[model samples]
Target: MRTPVDDFQPGFAGRRSSVAGRNVTILFLSALTIMAGATISPALPAIEAYFADTPEAAILTRLVLTVPALFIAFCAPFAGLLADRYGRRKVAIVAILLYGVAGVSGVFADSLFTLLAGRALLGVAVAGVMTVATALVGDYFSGPARDRFMGQQAAFIGIGGIFFLTGGGLLAEFNWRAPFLVYAVAFALVPAILAFITDVHRPEALPKQEDRGLISGFFLTIPLAAVLLASVLNSLTFYLMPTQLPFHLKALGTNSPVLVGVAIGACTLASALFSFFYGHVRRRLDVSAVFALGFGFLAGGLALVAAAGSFAAILPASFLVGSGLGLIMPNLGSAAMAIAGEDNRGRVAGLLTASIFLGQFVSPLVSQPIAERTGYAAVFGLGAATLLMAALVALGLAGLRSRRQPA
Candidate 1:
């Protein structure tokens, strides 16, 4: 069997010398997934007001923020297949170029439908970027290195969210379209990608006679399925903050875009801090233990959001939510990458990406009606209850796994 070391071509020693550059490049690439939604979240209210005359303006405005996720959910599997068949580098570069074009097109949109169309194309770009970026992480690192890198990757994304969300909020003060300009940053990363990333080769896949479907090959595994489920749930719950929090804050009589940015940035800040420590935490706890811990934090945070009477109360709740997500994000990536083999890393990465984004797309669909009927507090309370149940399940599973282990 070819080791990760042998998967690289010649001149790898020179590449190894610049590992920091390579890691930074990929880390920024990973941040693009978070940026896809976050950079525009602060502008959501502004966009809604701007297009108030449009039918279903409220739902359609939220869709502007989440439509990319729907596209990512659909296109990521195909992106993974392409990466596996051709190369990560080629697909990533093309995606980055497309990301800049589609993302910026929102600034020129005259109608809600035009903006949604651009956002859908942006989603296609993100599917490729997110899939290949993750596959590259798996390709480039293994074992403890992979764990540490996953933690750092999550941290970087959180940090990026701080800047993007805060900046978007500030920019929205000028014009709803101002936030769309941030997507232009994607173009700057193309040069870094070219400088630091190299494609890793894998052995040819199994014969046609032996091959099962890609989804069946990985999804059928209990551990992988559990990880993907966790990802989906985690994303669904985390996204509630972005998709609903602004409206929640507005309902509480605090509607400033900057304050909205700060509130969400507080969550990202906590996520970054906790994510920085994930590798250390992973050393002591198994993935199940981490999941239990993360879900516990999420439950507490959402419960706090449910109970909060003022905008100030939401800040600490945001921190708690961020803390839980910080741990869960890296854990999901590490666990999924550990389960995937070299040959199918791209496909596994793609599916994982799909699950994560799918939950984002579904968040508003699930929470909006609940919020509309019972109010935002009830929606948050329901999320807290659901997460609490998930935490208990994780703890139970952890105990069962421990008892099954040979002494």
Candidate 2:
């Protein structure tokens, strides 16, 4: 990978240093990343009961919430190629429109299958929205500025999650359909994205790598691969909160959607708080060090969740997990982009986005059977153990890298 020194040099062309409307638009779009799977989380049980007659309602109801991740995982790579070949703004605008349409389509869905179909379309839209918006971020910023904005982007997404989750909970109190209305907010952003977002020129072919004056594609692939692997593991565990927290709360005898939302929001709010300070955290730690801190907190937090006896006890545990995620999210993106060829930034961002969501889609698949056997609390315990292993691996790798480098 290239040093920070190489990243900031003039060879890499990007937007000006000053903040602009385009930055605001991309940040707003980032909020939708969590919304894809989480906004409907607070309503999962209600939907299941509402569709009690549907085949496999217990599982399919959850699929209505999670299926978007599957679609996004599959479609994001194509979305990236489109963003690269076509214009980023054009792709984003259409995606935003589809996001609103497909998201709200759930309000009229009469069966589990229909809802899953709508959510599937929503996934395709989100793939376009997320991939293009992220690629645009890389196109428009470099070095510390890119790092700062990515941190801000994650923070904003957390803030959005607080709003969406809490709002969905309160809305779910009335009807599961109400929360779907929140997706229509994307339509309002259409004008702003059109007005402010512009496409960066992408070359058809990359330099021969040697002339590029950066790490070879082969060497750069190593860290990118590592980052993608971490993305999958991080998301697999990170998602337990949103996907299982409602049921976990239900098990503890708290059934209010509003309370459920608030419980989930506690984690997101903490994530926002930590994410807002991620740039400061980055300055003090290397990428591997930051990842280690993240996984360590994640492990400890999940362990606490497994042992917590009541709702109040779970809040701080969730916050620790959130903080770990806040620290880890930006580092993964920044690390990948740090080594990516400028021409293929869109494709790379797409792959990263796909990996993250694929992990999310797979989480319930892996966790459900475990939860059935050991209960939700034990599910968290298992996740914590996995995260502990990840933390140890990261720490070991960082030590190895340190030893290989000059003092």
Candidate 3:
């Protein structure tokens, strides 16, 4: 966007650029992005049971988990604008503080509606933290450095997802309220952020030659549109495990939260492992090829899930899906960064974040009806079909682009 100028900048030096300090802070905060929806996933069945007497309890209980995603989709773009106008550090600090407060408030809510309200507030908090955290990555690093850093960050989030989902399952074994305690961890991040993280540029100032037109131009490009479309479909299918797997496990004759958590957590673990090596994968493959590989794995995994008869089968299926996500997540993020310059990084990151969560929010809506009619297994079949189509589309597009390029 800055007229193709050199990517590096003369950033803040001294303690502000201490790699270890800032990386630790950002990695810790990145975990919060997963917390918005996944932390409560292990307890979904229990929550539904608690409110069983209420009208439409099944749907509303699922809403309790996904409602935050809906709010995040709506609020993140505005949050990005705020971070751009205000300092990123300031917005992030406030957001983290609110995240803890709203996240923990779920423990004391007397009814489903009260908890829904708290979840909605948690979404607003997540929008700010997520947008600012990703924008900071762009602000702090560039080129191959940025690619490696994004992969590392994706690994952290995947690992965090594993921890939170498994811990939530164990906590739900005692009571539904117990998992809310994990939200308190956000409070500990505040001081660390204040001491370590610093803004890369002055608030509201654009780098030279980084015209507003270029920002708009980048957003309208075909590559960005393809990345976002793939991201949306990928998220919608990936989320099926988290949002509906518990119910599926229940239908399979096991109601133990630990087993359900382990089933879903397997995907996260695989994703983390793949993300840790994403840099190596990226060195050999272009973005579209990576996407094609990812979707192919996703398709195969979903097919396995659709036919799965036991937890053992689901475990391997989850791993395959996770592997695909590992390939897709970091590449999509870095692709966004490649298109955006510093001036619009926050806004672009916000839009990307919004697309991801919006798919999550819609996952249940799309799956619920099919699940209600045919059963949960049908949902996986649908996901498999969707992902297979996506893979074909990606590969075809890649072939076309390759042919069009000058040799």
Candidate 4:
């Protein structure tokens, strides 16, 4: 073996060596990040009821969520910088443990302010975990291998969402505290992380400080921008479907929580199935085509909901939308990373993660006010139009990308 004099710096982000153990560690981190999101959603109604002082006060609980999403959007790039600087393992450990501690504190929160504080803290931690984990994946794998694993991440996260939603739903029926306790899992995972994940960085992982800032101006290409915008739209569609759709159904005189859960759950399940076949589908279809199809599905699904008089109709419509969403994510991520290059992969992925959260933040806030002003259908119309715009942009990007490439 070469001596230490070989000056090998195959740290975590570096391509020094491949180890399955490291991958497992990364996947674990992803699970916690997803779980953080999963757990909060089901308990939203309970949270509102707990703070039933005013509609305005109740909205603060939502801030717990929207704040995290927004913060993740703002802070993801910075987190990546720290990960690449200090070391992936160290960064992940500290951030993850913080996420767990703050996240679990929600269970004991006695007031709205306390809960909000916990959620806000959790958001900062989530930014770190999400950006670093994705960056690590980029460093660890390339090409088909990376594609497959991201698909796996997509599918598995879908599965996790189901568990969180279903379990949180059930718990909300009993007491809201049930879901907040899910953060205990994060705390448990920390020891495993410390034991398994190595703090290595690849030599070519990210450019030096002098070069890093300059790359973003060039790397954030037109195609990549379209995908980021699409990511935001995708999140907008997701949030609109749940929060607004239920209100729409209520206007029709239906309030079956079970039915609502079933609709959203069906949509997520459909997305999971689409994620499973992401690779085969990607090989046969272009990325723009794949994303456009998803956008089409979302548009159709929303339009159907807009016209839906019966809850029975909402289920199939949601599935269609989910299929479209599921198809878009794996392709969007793969395409983004492909164009982003290794140097800015973490920051790019961070941007992607932020877009998703920001989209979620905007969806309900935007759609609800529209619904209140006009009607349920009006909100859906907005979602459909937004999705259609995204589809158009994706197609245009495809054309520009094709013309720019050389033979």
- Candidate 3: where is the Cα deviation over 4 Å? 1-17, 207-218
Model 1 has an lDDT value of: 0.90
Q: Which residue pairs clash in candidate 2?
A: none
Model 4 TM-score on a 0 to 1 scale: 0.86
Of 1 and 3, the candidate ahead on lDDT is: 1
Model 4 is weakest, by summed lDDT over 10 consecutive residues, at: 1-10
Summed over model 2, clashes come to 0
Clashes of each: 0, 0, 0, 8
Better of 1 and 2 by lDDT: 1
Q: Write the per-residue lDDT of candidate 3 for residues 1-407, one digit (tens) a residue.
A: 33222333334334445657888888888889987777789999999999889898898898888888898889887787777667689989999999999999989988899999999999999999988888888887777777787889989999999899999999999999889889999999999888777777455456545544314445646877777787789889999998888898789887998888898889989888888888888887778888889999999998998999988889999999999998899888888878875667777878888888899899999999999999999999999999999999888877887888899
Residue 371 displacement (Å), model 2: 0.8
Worst 10 residues of 1 by lDDT: 203-212
Name the lDDT of candidate 2. Answer: 0.84
Per residue, candidate 4 scores C-alpha lDDT tens digits across 1-407 of 33111333445424434455556667777767667765666556557767888567545655655666777777777787666556667778888889978888888988888877788788888888887777766665567766777777677667776777677667666777877887877877677676656543543444565245523455677878878888887987767765666556666776554455566777778878888788778776678878877788888888787778788888888888888878887777787777765556666777777787778777667765677679888888778888888778767766776678796
* RMSD, one per candidate, in order: 1.9, 4.0, 2.8, 4.3
Of 2 and 3, the candidate ahead on TM-score is 3
- Pairs with backbone N, CA or C atoms under 3 Å apart (clashes), candidate 4: 11-200, 11-201, 12-200, 12-201, 13-201, 13-202, 14-201, 14-202
lDDT of each candidate versus the true structure = 0.90, 0.84, 0.85, 0.72
Models sorted by TM-score, best on top? 1, 3, 2, 4
Best by lDDT: 1
Tens digits of per-residue lDDT, candidate 1, 1-407, equal: 45464557557435656677888899999999888889989999989999999999999998898889999999998898888777888999999999999999999999999999999999999999999988988988888778888999999999999999999999999999999999999999899888878787443444554244456544448889899899999989888899999999999998999999999999999999999899999998888999999999999999999999999999999999999999999999999899987667888899999999999999999999898999999989989999999999999988998899899
Model 2 agreement with the true structure over 1-407: per-residue lDDT tens digits: 55322443332224453235667888899888788766889999999899999877877877787789899999997887777667688889889999999999999998888899999999999999888877877877777777888899889999999999988988899998889988888898999876666555344433444232112243337788899999999999999998888898899988999888888888888788888888888887778988999999999999999998899998899889988888888888888787765666777788888998899899989998898889999999999999999999999888887888898
